[model samples]
Target: MITTVQRPTPADWDSWYTAGWPAVVTDKESESFHRTVQPYPGMTAVDLACGNGQWMRQLTAWGVFVTGYDFSTEALRQARAAGLPDGLSYAQWDIDAEPIPPALMPGSLDLVTCRHALPYLEYARVLTDVGRWLKPSGIFYALVRVADDQDNATAQSDSVLESFHRGFTEAQIDGIGIGWARRTTYRLSARNCGIVLRGYGDSDCQPCDVSS
Candidate 1:
């Protein structure tokens, strides 16, 4: 079972970004994104908690128009300073505090992504919103740290313990997706996992699947 820990505040994120924290995308993450999302030139995507906009940049490179949201002003500032493409934009929005933006009309987006930030948000509500925001063929992708049984025994410091607390167990992750009528797939890595949720109306939607 995963234990609860104090969540990081927006101030904590601002401090980290101000300290020059790097946004690193792993090979597994890139591969999983490409394999699952299969972006096309005209696809539109929304990235939630898009710190530094690294994923936004990647998606834009594949010719997808992306709108990114982050809670930390400093993070959004750095992302903008890094330069935005013609089809990409960033906004400072706190997911926990605000309702889904009115601009994101029902069934308008092709993809919605929440990476490394799902554990911090009210994810059930987020999932429901994403379901409504996406087109019939749209997908919701999330990458999150997974809690392990060995975490408590192997953790070397308070930071490690805090990280453990922030993770969701495989069961917890599975349970969340099951509550909504959608196809759910899991792509597991050593310390993290990727989840893809497709609306039930989608032709390719299935009950569940697990892949490497």
Candidate 2:
């Protein structure tokens, strides 16, 4: 059965093993991912399913106007309590709901990062949505749970990719690799996690850049 996406409050979510944040297994090894999405001074980026706004906080520091969205009120409250910079903002939205308008900010946002959260939804549809939300030349950075060389049996059981696709499709895509290579980027595990696929999307069909 497909589980419905929910935005639980910190109060209610705390009753579980972990509270209201968009985190995967509370593994000590899962490092905090910082999307190195180079944008202009006034670029806008959205952190979808932002757990505790860790990267959200960093993005704002990098001069990108960051907007974080999650269903967890506790997470949102914590983000607010953290006293973010002037350009930082937060909103609540259920991930299971399809085509949510308010959450989809259209062409205004320059980048959208959905780290450690893609396995929970329909990958194709979610990709389509990200494509819709981005500006003509925007970026979508994601970290999906996959069977990349970093898997233990226990970890695999809880993988979001396992929860969705029976198997996974691993690709190193970039702007030049896809139909619209000059306008897209696909950097798989370029930064932190060894298995994570990092994508830098432009207004293209999603490919990779070989020169970089």
Candidate 3:
């Protein structure tokens, strides 16, 4: 299990949201997302730590049914105030404090995504739950900051360094042991990266055709 020594509480995130921290999708993140996920009409998806519902909105735009989960009430409020699309919904759930929701049945989900929040989550447990919840052809996608010597050297504060210390190494990701049939990792930037994992039952292990 990936242990997190320190993580932001819901109140901290509420304050951040109140201070206008938008869930801005950067160009690199967009590129990585498009490359990693292919949503079809009627597909079911869940976005973890789905601040402000940016990803849920995007997936719904592509005709997918999306349920966004977040711990911050303020973030969910902002997300709802933005207007939910036909197939989009939001729920408040503190992943660290709670077990996986009973609504997420085994083999029920087509896709699962976590962006910019994996370092704060119990990722091993999350991965196991994702593996159980996903359909045979489902994918688990994650975007996270990378921990490296450069990041450590450039960290602005003790808190920043602590967060960086929680970030994953490429080797760490490879050793996560979710028994995926296929796993692909790619860099989004010098300090950020993404991964795509398919379950053991997924026979179509070929990479997505999208350009890197």
Instruction: Judge candidate 2 against the unseen true structure and give its global Cα lDDT, from 0 to 1.
Output: 0.53
* Best first by TM-score, ranked: 1, 3, 2
Which candidate number would show the highest TM-score if scored against the true structure? 1
| TM-score-best of 2 and 3 | 3
Q: In model 2, where do residues sit more than 4 Å from their true spots?
A: 1-36, 148-207, 210-212
Question: On residues 1-212, what C-alpha lDDT tens digit does candidate 3 reach at each position?
Answer: 44445666688678778888554777777766676666678989999999988777877877889899999999999999999779899888989798778888999999998987776777777888888899988988887777754543443245632433346665565564346777777777776777888774455444432223
Q: How do the predictions measure up, each by TM-score? A: 0.85, 0.62, 0.84
lDDT score of residue 166 within candidate 1: 56
Question: What digit string (tens of lDDT, one per residue) describes model 1 on residues 67-114?
Answer: 999989889999999998889999888897877677789999999998
**Highest lDDT: which candidate?**
1
Q: TM-score of the candidate numbered 2?
A: 0.62
Q: Where in model 3 is the C-alpha error above 4 Å?
A: 149-166, 200-212
Number of the candidate with higher lDDT, 1 or 2 = 1
Residue pairs in clash, model 1: none
Number of clashing residue pairs, candidate 2 = 14
lDDT of each: 0.76, 0.53, 0.75
